[model samples]
Target: MKKSSLILASAGALLLMAGVYLAFFVAPDTVVRIDDRELVQFSQKIFYFHVPVAETSFVFLVLGGLFGAMFLGTRKRSYEQMSYAAVEVGFIFVLLVMITGVLWTRAAWNVWWEWEPRLTTFLVLTLMYSGYFVLRSSVQEESAKARFGAIFSIIAAVNVPLTFVAGRLDSLKPVHPKVFTLQGASMEGPMLAAFLVSMFGMLLFATSLYIMRLDLLRAREDIEYLKEELEVG
Candidate 1:
């Protein structure tokens, strides 16, 4: 591993820890009054991580789509590998988002799952990328597999915006709120600070993970090439 990557990973870890601490101890507690009763839901803290992970996942999914397009255009194995790595990372983060989302839903809405627009579309997005891996594996030829994966990824990215807006547009009330905005009064200062720190931390962590995974994949490809050369010799 490169020293720079290690440093970056460490920084990410530290920032995440700080964000967690601030979320738990420093951010103002949210108290919602229901029927003249004040309800303090600490589960709201999940927002710090959940929203960040979701945003990160979307960003990486877009990167995967872009790299996939590049691979299709240039027929470069490097771009293909990059696209795969980005999708893999995005999938993992999306899973994290799902888990946290479920927890938040249970806490806020008293349901483990719902057939709401956002959740449904998000699940579809997950399945689409999951199918990308399946399609890649089912094919025997490397060139053919890469081509299919690239095309599939590009097509799947069409759902990104839809998934993002589904909750906002749903008539059936969703537990997920549209908290993100440019308006200065939307969130408290400490809460915003914690959210921003968590986001930056997750971005750094995702970048480090992508670089490390790409390097590992490249190493495996090199080893396979060497083995083939030896056999040919």
Candidate 2:
């Protein structure tokens, strides 16, 4: 491995360990109550990972779109490769979001699922990116696949913003009361720290994943090229 890769791998592993420590040990407790009865305390602890993964997924979603735009502008395969990596990373984070969100619902809402806007939006996110992968696979030609996939990726990512907007358009359905409530109020100290740590950890993890995946992809491409050269020779 190159020195940069080795250094980054070491740093990423350290950060991942630190994040685990901060989350399990340093993070404060969360409590949920009804009529002065403590129904959930430590159960709410999962919120730290849930919200952060969900938010980090959003960051990657936008990043994929930006890379898609760059691919179109530059007509380069590298940008397409980077965009593909970002989308894959984004999908993993989205899955984490769904898993954590379900846990939170079971803990706080006493139900395994709810038709909340955020939840629905995340579901849409999963589908949109899934379509990206499908579209890529359907094309047999490499250059054509990359070209068309870039277009589809850009379009599919638009659903993210649309899904957010659609959530607001629905005024009648039951929505999570987030306006001026304790929910939206500034997160307290330990809670804030836990949240920040979770987000930063996931973002760093995603970055590391992107680098590793990209390197593997480039290596595969090089191998394929060498094989083709040998066959011709």
Candidate 3:
């Protein structure tokens, strides 16, 4: 592992632990009043992790798209490798978002799944990115594969914003909670602090993974090049 990635991974791990501690111990439980009765919602604690993972996924996906564009513009193999690595890391976070979301839904809504606007759109986004890998694998030529993959990555990244806004649209009537608005975050200070910690931790961790993946991809390319040279000799 690269030194920078190692440092990031270590810091990420420490911050994640601190975030968990703050979320459960320091942050106040959500309180809701119903018929003059107060109820504490422990399930709200999942917000600290769920929202962070979702945001991290979006960041990585966008980076993937940006790198993909760079690859297409310059025809640089390095950019292609970065794009692929970012997407792979982003995909893993997307899966985590889905899993954590389902768990949060089950805890808060008493149901395993819902056809809400946000959830539905996110599912579609997941499927779309999954097809990216399929597209890459189907193409035999290296340049053509990268070209198609870059296009698909860009298209999939565009969907990220749509999925984010799907929950906010008035027409959709989404059940997903809106924590942030033009005014500010709905969370109190401690909750926000915990969330921020977790968010940064998740981002750093994802970045480290991307760097590691990029290293692996470059190593594989070098191996292939050496093999080709040996065969030619």
Best by lDDT: 3
Poorest 10 consecutive residues by lDDT, candidate 1:
174-183
lDDT of 3 at 24: 99
Model 2 scores a TM of: 0.87
RMSD of 3: 2.5
What local lDDT score does residue 38 receive in model 2, on the 0 to 100 scale?
A: 64
Candidate 1: misplaced stretches above 4 Å? 163-184
lDDT of 3 by residue, 1-233 (tens): 79999999999999999999999999888777768998887888888898888888889899999999999999999999999999999999888888988887788788899776656666877898889999999999998999999988998898778776865676745455643231345586987899899999998888888889999999999999999999998
Q: Write the per-residue lDDT of candidate 1 for residues 1-233, one digit (tens) a residue.
A: 77767988999999999999999999887776668998776777888898889899989989999999999999899999999999999999888877887887787677898766656767778788889899999999988998898888888887678766765675766455533332557477898999999999999989998988898889999999999999999
Error of 3 at 179 (Å): 12
- Best candidate per TM-score, number? 3
True lDDT of residue 210, candidate 2: 78
As a whole number from 0 to 100, the lDDT of residue 59 in candidate 2 is: 83
Kindly list the per-residue Cα lDDT of model 2 for residues 7-122, writing each as its tens digit.
Answer: 65667567656766776788665555668886536665676677777777888877888898899999988898888888888889998888887877776667898888778898
> Between 2 and 3, whose lDDT is larger?
3
The deviation in Å at residue 78 for candidate 3 is 0.5
| Residue 86 CA displacement from its true place in model 2, Å | 0.8
